[model samples]
Target: ARPDVILPESSLLNLDGVQDAKLHPSLGGFQSLYDEGELAIVQNVGYPEQNFSHFRSTDIWMTGADTNELLATGWLGRYLNNQYPNYPAAYPNEDVPDPLAIELGYNLSVAFQGPVSGMGMVVGDPEWFYRLVNNIDAPVPDTQAGDKLRYVRLVTKQSQVYGEVIKNAASKITQQGGYPDTELGEQLKIVARLIAGGLQTRLYMVSLHGFDTHDSQVLNSDHTKGEHANLLATLGDAVRAFRSDLKGLQIEDRVVGATVSEFGRRIISNASLGTDHGAAAPMFIFGKHVEGGILGKNPVIPETPDVEDNLGWEYDFRSVYASLLSGWFCTDSSTLQETINKPHEILPIINPSVCGTTSSYENLYAAESWVRNYPNPVTDVTTIEFKGTGKPIRIDVINAQGQIVETIIRAKVGAGTHQITWDASRLTSGMYYLNYHNGAIHQSNALMKH
Candidate 1:
């Protein structure tokens, strides 16, 4: 069977002030934010050995586990548990007066699943939980049944205490105006209020559904008016409003936000006029301190797209996670390795002027071996230098499609600092990756040539 060469009509077009990109019409707010130097996009973000199933892929992303590995705890959960070892024993104290994480929903997300239990609170309504706490009656009789009852009481009592803390924090500030009256907007509005109220929560999670557009993604008459468009509109408007509120409270510089999804849609459309599950997609990061620009080269579209084909990943998704941990939180290399459970390259997503460079990056690859290239965004030629033990070294230059375009070095190099002059004049101006491996030390880095 042959596939059709039909292309889906979209309102996506290049907008003013946005560099090297096209955006849907509903994403005007995001476009404006980018123009103001407060937003950046990382294209082709995905992991190796991607799973296509919704549940399994989502689980892999939530747990931050390799595709073949199964983890009981989540990425953030492990980090939080490590940071606050004695959590829930005597939490909400003066030293740590608020929850470690908060999800604006009724059920705790698996991303907060710790080894013992969920680490974050799921707050739907504080008053409801407060009333439930007050409704607890007299103590039960001294028996096995009483023991279970007491445990339940303790859990509810903890919830009540957290409810009080949330109430106090939320009462400290009112949200600024201009938030859309949509679900995402309301959820983000609450988050803004909590942050403004002086809640010291380090992480917050909120979701906007309806991205699983397998059928009728767009209207037959108008490609711009449909499920996907509505979702983008809600997202862009809410995020812009959230940013304005944060600026109003003068906490814009203190917070950063990024979007994630399990997978992207296939390049080819189906008979239902919708897209099926696909591969790598773009992820956006926005904040006052974000280095505003596109991170990687755009995904390459084939001459004739196939139904079973998918986009290749340029940047491993974990690299972005590692970058945020190191650049934003100033996490140590040891802790960063423990958190992600692997070594991935760190992209320059944060503005070094605001957050400063991480001293932990050199140590992230290995204690004995570390590599870096000079004159980034190079012009014709650049220097590639690295330190390593006496071992066979292999360095491959990879393109945006995850293809190894050149193998610059593949020979045994003695221990100590080494340098290689790479003439990139023959290579086109775009984002490329340097994959270096020597003995047990292996790492990846991004390179840009102007």
Candidate 2:
């Protein structure tokens, strides 16, 4: 039997608060993008019965397969497979000169793993790729694994060809403003330059890591702030700055950006004050051509769950991909249906008219919350343990008749688990409510006075 690894049975606090803000304060940069209609927010997104492991879940996402199935060809790879038939031999011709896809900050992902061979390249940096490809001159292979070596050689050969072209394009443009000096910002900065310099690359993938916040997610007694805050800030700043840079270069209309994660943390916080992997999180889509708005409602967080399935299941992730393919890239529904092995409904996330008869995509990044007050049946005084946003939060104590008894808390709170002592020595013994209200989040905890 799995014991309660997080909260005790007497869990209390009041974090279900009204949320009016699109993002947390730490993510202010992203908020600006949303205001400009450059962000489309899709909340509560996940596959049905989502897998929790990082590797398996990422594989499922990349290859567009269910947890029980495995696909050698990636969803994107299948798309490219159709784009360039007889790919390896027919590619590098006049019609297909540049690489079809480019990935930054990692090796080739399964997203580009084609049926025969992967149909993409991974360049950590344009300049570095230039030097590496230019310097390499491997002699003809004399090994028995001739076919495999030849494939390897072909990848290298293409890398060399792309290296010079990418390098030249990168040199022609520079990022304009507001980019954080962080890894995500740097990688996105490279993407902006390459795009501005006239690289007709259809698919480019960049990454930001460290979303696996299993323990110490927030500071002790201050659940509002911690490692997750910094990560969210980095994301906000990177995307905002990248968009600004693109607009400055007058190419903002040509690109769209989507932010996705493999899974969301469970509603219940673990004993270490962090969350376990769960299903149905949010996805962010940003671009000038986006039909900016919230695609669906936020995932409903339950008070207590007997099973992981208690977490709400919402828009499957494949729907987002289908919309992007059919509406954004103008790919037909039949092709996407065949490639993904599912007839995922189009989400209407992209602006159809932006790219001249293309098909149609909100940014909401608020922190998750928890609360617990011990000694519920107290005689005189009681203590409330509240998990809140990193910014200032307002806690109100109300009597049974829906009148404010007292304003218990109103201040900027740090990250992690927090506690507040509430003295109800003056009020008559009766039922009451403890309410927590941040800018957009609103929640209440019922209190029994003895």
What is candidate 1's CA lDDT for residue 326? 76
Stretches of model 1 off by over 4 angstroms after superposition: 1-10, 13-19, 125-158, 362-450
What does the lDDT read for residue 409 in candidate 2?
Answer: 86
Cα TM-score per model:
0.76, 0.69
Q: Return the top candidate by TM-score.
A: 1
lDDT of 2 at 204: 90
- What's the lDDT for residue 224 in model 1? 74
- Residue-wise lDDT of candidate 1 within 112-194, one digit each (tens)? 88888888888664334334434534568899999899889778766566777777876676546678988778778778878
Tell me the tens digit of each residue's lDDT in model 2 across 216-277: 77767544467677788889889988998998999998889898788777766677656778
The CA lDDT of each predicted structure is 0.76, 0.70
lDDT of 1: 0.76
Candidate 1, position 130, lDDT: 33
